[model samples]
Target chain A: MEISDTELMLLGLVAEMPRHGYELEQVIVHRAMREWTAIGFSSIYFLLGKLQKRGLIRAYTSRASNRTKAQIPGADSQISDQESEPNTKPRKVFTVSKKGMRILKNQALRSLREISAHYSSLTRGLLQWPFLSREEALAALQDRLEALRSEEDRLSGLQLDQQPLPDYENAMYDFALSQIESEYEWVKRTAEYMETKPWN
Target chain B: MEISDTELMLLGLVAEMPRHGYELEQVIVHRAMREWTAIGFSSIYFLLGKLQKRGLIRAYTSRASNRTKAQIPGADSQISDQESEPNTKPRKVFTVSKKGMRILKNQALRSLREISAHYSSLTRGLLQWPFLSREEALAALQDRLEALRSEEDRLSGLQLDQQPLPDYENAMYDFALSQIESEYEWVKRTAEYMETKPWN
Candidate 1:
């Protein structure tokens, strides 16, 4: 079964542990997962719903969570008789089913093993280089270098904030940095060429 | 005006010269543009229609093309009296209008100057590394290395085929190859770490 990258990412998170939508959002934010995945807060609930429909994940209110809730003053008063129905509840914690775990493992393995090309608008712009005047093209390339530097700084700041990262997380950050540096080098070289080379 | 990368690419091509749908497809294929953009043959006409509605491109039957068609035996007999109606013609060539050129230039410059994050599923899989056993993870990394090698070969071959490429086109290919190589290095390092590091 083909699953979208976003779906697989959500499944992997749920497989790690039972988490409420808010907790999922927190984890995503704390880890800066947005750098690598285009997931929004609203999509977390939507994806969770989809995962539940697919039998990949199921929602449940753990006894511990319920007990903690009960400890809060007047919490018991707000509890509905149909406590089993988690769909209507505002804070439904989700756990991956056995099927969900299986799918997650399969999808993760497939993703790790496969390589796919990403389309960048930079390529489109580069291919149409002749369309822009020399001055405009040079200015654009200079701006790109500045943007890349800002990106590098942002990524470095994120990496520093998450200290004591697991080896894998550290490696991920390094990988991202390396990509930026590579692009930066290419842009610098291209800019020099654009400056010195004759234009039509 | 904001245009999709695909729209900008098509507009750039039309700006290069008046071309029919088939000719655009040929140019795309010949230049291996698919590596940089996700455009399908069917979407060419769909996008063309959209560009026309936006007044960025206008279709015309150039006299040169029509004259060539008239040179064919029996072609004049097939010509309708309402020759001005290009919509009914099989080969209506599209050219970028003044507005289209202006918009294309602005969009291309913006694209060149901007940097945006692209979400990769591999990051998701890496973050959830604990989900897989050592054996499975190691095997997946091995497969990734192999996949990267194959991609490198394919890109190298494509680069070779497009000899005498413009400086910009050559740089684009180099940028792509550098990204792959960077990832290849990261994957190799990651795989080694995964192999040697103690697992929880």
Candidate 2:
């Protein structure tokens, strides 16, 4: 069973630890998931609802959140003491259900088995290069090579904040780094092939 | 001037040889354009209409096509021949306009120059692998390695048919080959990494 990309990301994050929708939103934004996957802040709630209805995740109230909220100060002296009240925070954090784990495992298996392709419009344009001059094609491919390297740098520079990077994250980083480097090498090769393969 | 994948293909094919819709459809199917690009049989006419309206292509009569239609075996022979009289075929053969060539050239430059990422689902899934078990992940990676090799073989064995493969086609094949081989190596490296990387 194939889950949507957003669902997969959400479940993956939740399985790491129970997270509120807002926290999940922040994590996705920080990681720039929107650029890669078909997801946005607005769609987060709707997908959670759908996932919950399907029993992929369950909502839990977090007392830890309530304690954190209660730590806020209320002015000075008697004013603070007399006015203190229960912070009453019932943050609805979500944790992945067993079904979600099964889905994630299956999705991973399918993705790994699926054949990769250059299915972008850019590749499409490259495939049908009839009118493009060799000079223009060379320039364009060079520009792509430059861009790929910059992306490689960006991925390599990614930080996991103050926490030690998890093994899975290292794996993910390694996977992404390998792909970017592979594509960088590919664009360079394409340029060489284009130079020899004339369209006249 | 970002042409849709179908439009790019249609223009490229029409530019190759003035062809009717059926001929274009057959070429796309034979080339497996739909597998790599977002195109379908149903959208063929719709894209043709859009392209024609945009002055990227224009319909014209071809006496050669008319002759071909006339050669079709008549189920009603003499009666059809008498009715055929002038054999007024309304075939809408299309050829690329000057503007279409310009668009194709420009689209190629833009696609090559633009940065590429997550254009495929595999990249997105790899970005966020958290909950999956190491055992399952290793198994999946191994399976992917097998699939990638067979795909590599399929691409390597692609026959250029009676015609010598066009320069542009060779570039496309080489580009595809490099990517698959790159991925095959990447997965093997990843499986090795997974074996060493602990999930604690």
Best by DockQ: 1
lDDT per residue as tens, model 1, B1-200? 79998898999999999898988999999888888888989999999999999999999764565555455676543554246346445567899999999999999999899976765556767866878898998899899889889988999899999998888888888888888888888889878877887984
Against the reference, the lDDT scores of all candidates come to: 0.83, 0.72
- Candidate 2 CAPRI-style tier: acceptable
For model 2, how does the per-residue alpha-carbon lDDT over B31-81 read when each residue is reduced to its tens digit?
766645767788888898999999999998756644555578765556655
Q: TM-scores, in order shown?
A: 0.87, 0.81
Over A8-41, each residue of candidate 1 has an lDDT whose tens digit, in order, gives 8788788887888888889888878878778878
Candidate 2, residue B22: the lDDT equals 79
* Model 1 interface DockQ: 0.66
Where's the lowest-lDDT run of ten residues in candidate 1 chain B?
Answer: B79-88
Q: In candidate 1 chain A, where is summed lDDT lowest over 10 consecutive residues?
A: A80-89
Clash pairs, candidate 2, are: none
The alpha-carbon lDDT assigned to residue A25 of candidate 2 equals 93
